[model samples]
Target: MTAATAPTGLGEAHTVYLDHLADADEYAATDLAIGLLDAGVPAERVLLDLVAPAQAEVGERWARNEWSVAQEHAATHISEQVVAAVSAHARPDPTNGRVVVACMDGEWHALPPRLVAEVLRLRGWQVTFLGASVPAAHLVSYLHRYDADAVALACALPMRLPYAHQMIEACRRSDVPVVVGGRGFGADGRWARRLGVAWAPDAPSAAELIADERALRRVPPGQLAHLADDEYASLVRRRSELIDGALAELRERVPAARAYTAAQLDATVSDLGHIVDFLAAAVYVDDASMFTEFVQWLVEILGSRGVPVGAIALPLEHFGAVLRDFPRAARALALGRAALPGVAR
Candidate 1:
């Protein structure tokens, strides 16, 4: 069934599952998922319908600042446990070739891909799930050793797209067909197209794509001729300088920032770095919306935590001014600036 129509009672099961996650009751969460399996609910439904949606809500709660990092971590641990419990209960033998599932390097959000891996296993693929932040070299080496039919890479954040491209290329060099998924590829997998890789919107689609050898390898070449401009490269080389300058500017112009505690300063630095990294990724893909979308997300995240719009406005303007000679980077920053709430274009 499509996302709009979850199996009967799965909606209420989702609510109860979320409550269990919020309470950090791992035992209850596992029991609830296992209980579904016992009640004749498909294991795939247990994962995609029940566990997947609940994990997404966990992220939403964390993003809205309603859940502390510790609480979110606790909830995620329980979800992982539930996945393990479900996988063990529905141990399907492999009838297909091996598929290696992993998160892209520098991407620590492994749960989304973990769910995908389990679904592939349930569908009878000899799935080997390599969880979280796998470097490209090690991944290619492992693929060679394991004789993988295809490798499915996961990237959750857009900022990791550059690295994702690198990993995809590494897999190609090793003669392994690659299929990528997750938010890093964009909601419609447009960025994956930009990188010229096969992309699946979700687990089932990924399974179907992996099963279709001709279709998986027949994708068009990446449309990255924009990289010839060198803007993306220059932005990467100057990331450190850009973040340092932004932080210094913040300290000078925002008096409150000058007195920020250690944790606050680190977080500000991280936010500045994220802006630069996301802008660079936008430049890589030649999409202004990439940067603009990230700007909106950053604003909401910081705004929820009591940061003023000016705090974000200043950095966008600063990046724009600093990258004045780089047309694509400057233009992306300008579009990002226009996206800020209450900010004049």
Candidate 2:
């Protein structure tokens, strides 16, 4: 279906515009962004109020089974195009100083940081938008060479938090203040605080925090101190081992899985790997809730796709067996087991 240039008046056609996005029409989305500017709507408002909401709705659609992964990706691609159109129209004033925006390594979720980067640019910061999955070493070198006023990191998945922590620490060594954001930080940014860096709840707030003199100048804290009993490190080291054993056991116990097609089997293995990675991150950060929340979310996603939650839950029991001596992993596994539907404790 064709969508006209979005209502030039501020926010009048939000729902209609979102419908166009759901249809995977990039032209409709881009026309809306450009028309908003033509109507004298501020660039950032077009981005934050219009594009951002539609982008979020795309994710919600995928989460609810209304849209497949491909549809979600296509919608997001349209949103990115819209953001670019708006960004190109808004010239940077550079009065707010320099900032670096990057998505965490192993994190393919680039849209969040892309939004932040555009927001910073609109607010007159000399923002170097580093795109997605920038390696820690490259990021550190960039900070050292250009000497940014602050670094804003985006992480969407919980599994990326461990590597994000590494990036945060690397920035600290270069004396660049780091501001962490996105779902990976949780609702309150409790993990960001624990990792000993600043947190921004969203793009607008990230701009505000960087503009505020007091929050801007504070030096990033030194590396988070290590725990006395760091079972986390050991768990991380044996991650492949855990996934290998868990998959073998899952195939043995689940008769349906044994008869599955190659694609189905690959998806199952990938899901298990994600579980192991998330649990490792949880243990690395010494936080039980992250793993628990991830497990709950995974089960819900699986159930939505008509996959039995039991398939996901079974790994928890298996993980618990192998990681019996590891306190954090063991706790997370138990939480997963308890939260899974129809699973007996």
Candidate 3:
């Protein structure tokens, strides 16, 4: 199939796999994936075309409130199983140097990177699939110990870009060329460019990049001179204070919040913290759209779960007022507020 087209039967296969995910039927999901392999569908195609897109839909289902967190987790677990089954069914011996694949610190979305690792393996690279949230120091130590030819880092959330940058630099200090991918880098890998690392849009491109040492190491220097303004650093230092203050403001402004159940209150606190964290990351990257996009996503997620847009608006207004002295942060908050629905604005 060409780059723009899905294999003839794959679309139907994706639908069936998603149905299996929705049912939380691990055996059925695994059987379906392996059966595709048995039918002569390439293993990489099963992973990238079938399991990957199904997992993306699982996330969308949760975002739309059609699936609970429990359901999403169940589906994700099943997808992981299917990936493992596909990998085992088509195991290929490594014919190239070792590549260490891992998630950035604080990033728990390991499945995307796992697919990449398996793809690298299928293409004949020895891959050490270090699962989710591998810390920078530990990752650096492992790179040194194993003398990795290259490392592929994954970050599924844009909010973790700061940690991703740090981890990328740590690997560089050990003389390992780094290639990063995932939604965290933005769909175009713009954030990865901001950090001055090689970026792959998917597993196939990542495998190709890893094969060409010169291309992988030839990225331009990071364009983080704007960090000299110190807004990102200051925002991070005040993260806890910002979250607490936002929660206090929320409780005072929204009377019902004071009587929220423990679970509801925890969720509120988490959302507040995410706002500050996402804002900090945006500031770090000097991109207001990052914060704005996150606000839009947060609104959809919360709105689907019965939250009013005002619930999100109030926090944006609060953070804007509090960070008024920090130009970059204040500007980003303003853009985020503008991105809210008309009623909230």
In order, what lDDT does every prediction score?
Answer: 0.92, 0.83, 0.91
Query: Residue 126, candidate 3: how far off, in angstroms?
Result: 0.4
Q: Estimate the Cα RMSD of every predicted model relative to the unseen true structure.
A: 3.5, 2.3, 3.7
TM-score ranking, high to low: 1, 3, 2
Q: After superposition, how far is residue 70 of candidate 2 from its true place, in Å?
A: 1.6
Comparing candidate 2 with candidate 3, which one achieves the higher lDDT? 3
The digit string of per-residue lDDT tens for model 2 on 156-263 reads 987888789889889878987778899998889887877777888989899888887578556355344644577877877888888889888988998777898999
Lowest-sum lDDT 10-residue window in model 3: 1-10
Which candidate tops TM-score? 1
The estimated TM-scores of all candidates read 0.97, 0.93, 0.96
lDDT of 1 by residue, 1-345 (tens): 223433247888888888888889998888888777877899998999988988889999988999999999999999999999999999999999999999999999999999999999999999999999999999999988989999999999999999999999999999899999999999999999999999999999999999998899999999999899788999999999999998888889999999999999989898998999999999999999999999999999988899999999998988888999999998998888988899998
lDDT of 1 at 332: 91
Model 1, runs deviating above 4 Å: 1-8
**What is the Å distance of residue 189 in model 1 from its true position?**
0.5
Question: Which scores higher on lDDT, 1 or 3?
Answer: 1
- Which stretches of model 3 miss by more than 4 angstroms? 1-8
Model 1 lowest lDDT segment of ten? 1-10
